[model samples]
Target: MMKLFHSPTSPYVRKVMACVLLRGLQGKVELVPTSPMQNPGDLQAANPLGKIPCLVTEDGTAIYDSPVICEYLDGLGNAAPLFPAPGPARIASLTLQALADGIADAAVARQQGRAQQEEAGPTPRQAAFQERQLAAIRRGLAALEASPPAALAEIGAVAAACALGYLDLRLPELGWRATHPKLAAWLASVEASPALSRTLPPTA
Candidate 1:
């Protein structure tokens, strides 16, 4: 069985879990709850960057990052490809996934900054860091609203939805849905997928 090193709270891990469900490969993959912050070395041994959602194959090869894992899982099942096979559709899906990943990354950074302030004393630098991260996230959401991907049944769509859901979970003060109604509606449609519905994150 493939061992997945993941944290329940990680949007990236949730994205891969959603892919596994979508591809009907849940039985073949074993979920291993891991905390990168508490067990950094263990995750680092699997992925040098110490990221969550690392997939250690039965053969012992480790795949880091959600996109690569999603692609590999998609190939394992008889279902339609999570990524388009060729041309513009493929490019658009990949681009949307990248945008979504960017938003998630920004949110993570902002959360980290907040953690730093709470752990120690609030510093001017920390506030600036959070502001910059939140700005990037808002910009990415706006861009996604402007050019939404047409293929709503692919891994890219799943990734984007997971990112938005994470934002709702972690940064409700941002008011993303109020500003981007179209993106919010698109996310609602995507959330209806059985794969996504099964992997919805628990409220924090």
Candidate 2:
């Protein structure tokens, strides 16, 4: 069986877990809970970047970052590919994934900044940086609303769902749903997937 370094609240890990479910390979992959903030030695060795969602193959080969791991899993079975094959569809899906991932990154930055601010009130410059992150997230949400993915079964849709999920978990004050009704509706539909529901981040 393959081993997956995971975090209960990491949207990236949730993305990979969704792929595992989509491919119907849940039994083949073992989820080992982990955290990058704690800097676990094993996770660091498996992925030099010390990131969660790293997959260690049965033969001890380690694969990293959610996108790479998802593609690797896609090759393991005959299930429909979440990532489209080389062409325009592939380009569009990958681009959507990148944009969604960027949104998640911005959310993370803002949350971390907020935490720092709580610990030691942020300087004006730091507060401005955090606001910038929030602005980027809003812009990304608008772009997604303008051109939502056609299918929830694709990588692009999966990524967009994960990004919105992260925002809901960490930045509910953003009130994204009120501004991007299309994107919110799209996400509500995507959440109907068993893969997504089963991997939702733990509230605690």
Candidate 3:
């Protein structure tokens, strides 16, 4: 079985888990609970960049990053392609995925900054860093809401939904849903999918 190194709270990891369920590949992949901070060496061994959502294949070939892992899983089942073949539609979906991933990355950075501020002293220029990240997230959300995708099965829609869900999970105070009702509704629709519903993050 393929082994997936992941943290429960990671949106990227959640994406892979959702894809696995959607593609009916659950029986073939093993989930290994791993954290970057708690199991740095293991994560680094699997991925030199020490990222979560690394997939170690049966042959011990490790794949890092959520997109690659997702595509690999999609290939395993010949399920509906999360990513379409090369074309304008494919580019749009891939671009949306990239934007959503960027949003998730920004949100994670902001959360880390806040955590560091509360733990020890604040990191240098933490407020500025956070403001920039928040701005980027907001802009991305606005763009997505303005142009909602036609369907949710594609990689872009999955990424956008996961990004929004992560924001709700991590930074509720931001009140993103208030300003972006369309995006919020889109998220609600996507969340209805059993694959995504099964992987909802637990509330702390």
- Residues 99-170, candidate 2: write the lDDT tens digits: 999999999899889999999987998999998998899889989999987777788888888888999899
Residue range with the least summed lDDT across 10 consecutive positions in model 3 = 34-43
- Rank by lDDT, descending? 2, 3, 1
Give candidate 3's error at residue 4 in angstroms.
Answer: 0.3
Q: All models: lDDT?
A: 0.85, 0.90, 0.86
* Clashing pairs in model 2, backbone N/Cα/C closer than 3 A: none
Q: Model 2: what TM-score?
A: 0.97
Provide backbone clash counts, one per model.
0, 0, 0
lDDT of 3 by residue, 1-204 (tens): 999997778999888888888888889998888878765787798898888989999999999789998888878886787888889988998899899999999999999988987877766698789899999998998898899765668888888878887998999998998998888787777788877788888878
- How well does model 3 score by local distance difference test? 0.86
* Model 1 lDDT-worst window of ten: 147-156
What TM-score does prediction 1 earn? Answer: 0.94
Q: Which is better, 1 or 3, measured by lDDT?
A: 3
How far off is residue 66 in model 1, in Å?
A: 1.1
lDDT of 1 at 26: 87
Query: Lowest lDDT 10-mer window, candidate 2?
Result: 148-157
Model 1 bad stretches (over 4 Å): none
